[model samples]
Target: MATPNKENAPQHGTTGTAPLLLSRVAGNASAPEILIATMHGKEAVLAPALALLGFQVLLPVDYDTDALGTFSGDIRRPGTAFEAALEKARRACDATGVPRAVASEGSYRPSQSLFPGARNVELLAFVDRESGVEFVEYLTDVPTRFVKGRVPADPAAPETRALLAEIGWPAIRAMVVPNDPGEGVVLPEQVFKGIDHEAALAEAFRVCATHSDDGLVHLETDLRAHMNPTRMASVALVGTRLIERLRQEGYASAHPQFA
Candidate 1:
């Protein structure tokens, strides 16, 4: 997904007292090609920022990144998020035949703070094989609207409907799965996703209950970046952070110490 054009140059907006990182444009002379390793349309958010620094952003396809892991629990993500981001970037570079690439990864977990039930930790990475430079930046959003809970078999019940309303269902897009596995269900058919309508909700609940030993359905917000607007915004913010760093520095940029 090509990022929508904003302006030729990125705006210098800083949230804190820190100076805007728009001191100098990067890769302008060489105009390096940047391949964004993302399957969830993240380029739509990142390209404009990289464009400001005169980097051409490209999106590559036919990558089995899910073999690495997924936001959903269906496949477990490997190593730390920083590791995952760099690995994804390397894979994207290999696939596109581009030495410079960008990648993003997001981690969702219950908030340890007092604000909300959950937090979104978004990470972005840039890899330049020519310079042997691999850098990453990360940000955490405590105001994230992540929540999950279990619903009874009958979603048509009044209390269940109220729960749906509280979770902002039919808009946020929910996923339903069995509360527990039955004796013979190697792979339960209760995993229904992208569910937003009341009709689909009822059906998912019925199937999950009928197939599960616990007779209950587990419902959750779909945390995929493309599926969740809040998460996608975080991805964009992190991309901007990467752009800021690139503008302010050269080959070496600030990143968490990795071993």
Candidate 2:
């Protein structure tokens, strides 16, 4: 959790003389409840910033957010990350019965702007349904530690184990899929997601190999925020950026002209 430091305001495009917006939010009753839509556990990642902003966060129950998209490619996300994030915020607000909502969406892929290597683009959206005000912020990190490769067919081979070890293996979650996997084909019998143990990892390679025509398994480090610490950090940083935007917006409301 970042302390409310005035030194951090200037870079966020706020004047030093402006009062702490979080303090004003904390004292105001008209604004408190906020709904955040995310299936995997990230309360700890998001809670700290919301706490500083004096928001009572709400989460949905048994939400089928995978209908939008999935990190494992089982569900193809349509349109841009911004579009998906806005929908998430609106739907979450409706579900939680809150006028204000926050939601985030992220994607991992090779970047043309940063490097040819994998990059993480995380975006957070804040919506005020009553006021029709929306704020969306995003951040991209280069070399996000996102990695993928095919697993060797021979489960007992040293190189197979080495490949797993290189991806942080049991320490981090690994997911397996056929190189040309289709949606709904990512069943536990074939896809072998969330593998975090040596035995499960070996089984995943064997299972996915048999399903693949080339007898190889596509192995990838799971980029889900809850599964990957690197992604979680990116999300947390985005949370800070969103809070800063909200703070700046709050500061502007103090003056009629800016408002």
Candidate 3:
């Protein structure tokens, strides 16, 4: 059981696994492996950073991470992002037969004291079982790419095209879902590249609207690392922090508490 003072020891809906691991840094090649558990598709940005620190970075294949939660707002995650991140890290360690892991989780919303769309926060974590150390990091910004708008089902709506340009296109991808949140239908793949033709986008919107509860489609940026460059940048920043924590001198020394 995790202690109450622990940052991630609340009611996270996950099975049994140690909350953290610790590593004693040696020379370069023999450094312990660190698994980065994520469904946000972070391998490209994060793996390099771990490699730079001489720790092998691993990602699990068989686990269904969506069981934890998803970005489409369908599943209500039980714990805070920190708890969820530790759960994910523990899952990776269990699956790979390794003792150390790393994971990250992100949340986005408008500024509480501001207008409808204002700012966002991203949280990242690194969990080590050998030393029982879990390090947390965060970043905040008001220039997020999150936005949503309702468009008619019509294939040739002029307003839809205008909205597309308003949001950075051909670069930052958009999420397509039913305007009604209750319908539980989100088409993440329907995210169209702004570089694609207007006809393609119109068709995409039409398909989403046809199945929507209110015959309206909601469009917003995908926000996943591979989809949104802004998110990728954030992942890179998080990766740098994780690497630094792993390289700490205190982690290099032996500790009786771990034994």
lDDT of each: 0.64, 0.65, 0.59
Per-residue lDDT of candidate 1, residues 195-247 (tens digit): 87878887888777776657767777766666667777788877778987876
Per-prediction TM-score: 0.74, 0.76, 0.71
Scored by lDDT, model 1 comes in at 0.64
Estimate, for each residue in 1-259, the C-alpha lDDT of model 3 and write its tens digit.
Answer: 1111233221212234633332212223345566667655676677666655665455553345666766665555556666777787877676656677777776664435522343676667777777677777766672446666777766457766566666675477665666533235445553343324556666777777766767867766666666777787787777676666656734322423211
User: Which ranges in model 3 have alpha carbons more than 4 Å from their true place?
Assistant: 1-30, 110-118, 142-144, 180-200, 249-259
Q: Which ten-residue region of model 3 has the weakest summed lDDT?
A: 1-10
lDDT of 2 by residue, 171-212 (tens): 668888877443244554465777787677777776777777
Candidate closest to the true structure, highest TM-score: 2
Badly placed stretches (over 4 Å) of model 2 are 1-31, 111-118, 180-189, 251-259
How good is model 2 by TM-score?
0.76
lDDT at residue 222 of model 1 (Cα atoms): 67
Which RMSD values do the candidates have, in order? 10.4, 10.1, 9.2
Q: Which scores higher on TM-score, 1 or 3?
A: 1
